[model samples]
Target: MLFFTVFELVAALPYSYSEDLARTVAQLGALAHCSPEVISAWSCPLCKKLPLTNPQPFGLPDFNLSGYTGTMGTRLFLLFRGTEPESVINWIEDLTFEMVAYPHCEGCRVHAGFFASFKALRGQYFDRVQQAVSAGKEVVVGGRSMGAALAVFAVLDLARTFPEHVRVSYNMGCPRLGNQQFADWASKQLQIYRLVHWNDIVPHLPPRTLNYRHISREVFYDEPMANFSLCNDSG
Candidate 1:
């Protein structure tokens, strides 16, 4: 009975259908080649200038939850790094297919490998995110690929605890994170802009056969002429 009630609540969520090409490119670049030193220089369609200079950067020191925070017009951009080819071990290990119930939200499931990586930074980094919100900054969590998947879980947890503080989540080439119910619930809580490049295979990972579904609001960019379009949740 309770599960049915939750399903009803999630199914009522609406999907945003729009495309922002500039943001798609910028975020993809940041995911590939960004650091604390030059994060402010990263521009997007939403904010011409991120203004993240001298942001407070933190991570688990030995984990992938590494990120930074600073004001972008009263909003804080918390961006994570994707699986780097140089980090061969992390990249290879995170390909596992075990799906598990995410403890932070009811009816939410996530890749077990990504969730384990998230746990390493959950305590300290999560506190820092809370502090950033307490300082009156809206949070926008984002990433690409594996980092994008991590950001999905992080944003869901943040929305569950500090819904008012969470502004949105922007991910590029994000892999499938959870079930349809999880995607529906998350779309209701925050605006999730998932950007995909032409033939970018990362977003199709884990396969729908495993019950993996991407969150809604996808922006697709086709190369050569650089055409862009928006699609529904299934895209």
Candidate 2:
């Protein structure tokens, strides 16, 4: 949509998320749309000069294939994206998959307001997914680092907004982003998968929150190689 060409989309990304990271993420999104695969819909924002409680944060998920079609409907695996220098750019692409084609259900768009949620508009974004699943579509959710944390938030949102649509969520390298009480409450309601790379440091930055079931790992040897990291290669 907004970024028409592959090059255009890659160029629009922050320098921290590298072309490699963006490319890989794009591939991941594409692959996820396949039969029984996981798809991602990232919508994160970063605000340097805004208040922490600002109603509209400005981090984008940088997703691809917002207009996925299988003659079967749409299946998704959403990733929130973290703050690594390399993969941040990729996250941006995931968010803006296709300005014109970005997923929408009624008035319930991807960006469901920070203070406000489309919990009331459950079918707007997830109805199609449920239909697909009903017809038998395999969907999965995930994210890396902060993306993983955001994935957690998304599922909780979906549970509250559209409890019947979601079945499972697997987040990666997530480091707790919600309140302890809320986190515990959400964890009890859904099937969440949290994946972490080997000794991921970015996740530790904002300080992990309390609550929610978790899974961590230390598998990588260095950074930048993880370009699709939250930083988005500009770093």
Candidate 3:
């Protein structure tokens, strides 16, 4: 497989790559638990840009790892929910800080509790992604905040099974998901784009003091103007 460092990839981003789509996807991920009727009514470039319709717009009913999914054009989206009140409680209650090397991958260590929750919920959406891929469709996975953290885990696992099928991932205001080694490894394997807001304090959590590190290729924006600046490996 080929790998581009964060700097190289960002430099090559096309003008047509649509930051608007990225923001919309992030919003969808943040609202994963919202009702289907609301989700359907909310217009986004996913359908307008791609000219596809959602045959099935389903969201995970379980509160713990609730996520939303839908079909748009030849792309399948798997979006995870962010830190709601219950998720915050989970973060506080499960404060063991245990780190284990991710299975089937070398030199990658992740938060045990987060990884466990992601693994449990992943199977629920993985099938749909696989089905879409098998039918020659692209798969885009993303999330915001805590859901962004979970989405990273999902992409790491999914890449092993559907390398070519798994396309870009949009992580909005995501917390650090793993250690330096894991970040480096995941960056090389996936086209992961992290979006961070200047005033958004959530991305700074789990602390690097805990040995957590973010992946490469960040699109940062702030304040009055949401114009984005691309960064590499570092926020």
Candidate 4:
């Protein structure tokens, strides 16, 4: 078992939000949910010309992740798929509320199920990400739902190694993955754009009463394709 002691909070610099970038990232995240064939054939206007390579699907029989690693100009990207509607395992992972010690950081704990899913694909994803960093490219990670949680974990782990290269993470409908200690530690390590779409219940899950908390800089959209507000971390 792992345990942690309180660490002083370090104020993170505010991240500059760009709607265009967010839309592009969101497209990549959605593309992650597609089948391998679809992903290969994908011809979206936003990323059609970008050279996306190293496409692979990873996970166990019970848990799976569909994503790809690619680069556009100077930016390297790792995008992950969200929960599949018919995946019982995915829902099971989502509902498993137990908190386990996150060994990578002292006093950091994360949702057990989310961590499990992440572990299944961590090695493969890390290897590719490491290669990209070695090639001197800035990294951007993004995902939706459970994939978002996994992205958060990847960002933290990546930050441990290539702190300068692990640029930022863009997550949509992300649930709170860890306790305050983890959130505090993560906030200072990297810039995270947690996008919450108008009262989406997933972001509110495993409830704060259970000691789960979110990281800083939440981007909240109140209406469909309407204006968005940058929320304070307190929520």
- All candidates: CA RMSD (Å): 8.4, 15.9, 5.8, 7.5
lDDT of 2 by residue, 1-235 (tens): 0011222222232112223333333333233222222222222221222111111112212421122222212344343333455665564444311111113222221222211222322233355445545765544444555444455555665656455556556544555333333434454565654433445554443333222223222222234333122222110
Q: How does residue 66 of candidate 2 score in lDDT? A: 22
**Best-matching candidate per lDDT:** 4
TM-score of each: 0.75, 0.41, 0.80, 0.84
> Could you tell me which 10 consecutive residues in candidate 1 have the lowest summed lDDT?
1-10
Task: List runs of model 2 lying over 4 Å from the truth.
Answer: 1-76, 79-127, 133-138, 161-165, 208-235
Better of 3 and 4 by TM-score: 4
- Cand. 1 Cα-lDDT: 0.65
Better by lDDT, candidate 2 or 1: 1
Cα-based lDDT at residue 26, candidate 4:
81
lDDT of 1 at 60: 66
> Order of all candidates by TM-score, from best down to worst?
4, 3, 1, 2
What root-mean-square deviation over C-alphas does model 2 reach? Answer: 15.9
Q: Per-residue lDDT tens digits of candidate 3, residues 140-186? A: 88887778888888887887889888757888778777788888888
Stretches off by above 4 angstroms in model 3 are 1-10, 13-17, 36-52, 55-63, 85-96
lDDT of 4 by residue, 89-169 (tens): 567554868999999789999899888778787876788788888999888888888888989888877888998898688
Candidate number with greatest TM-score: 4
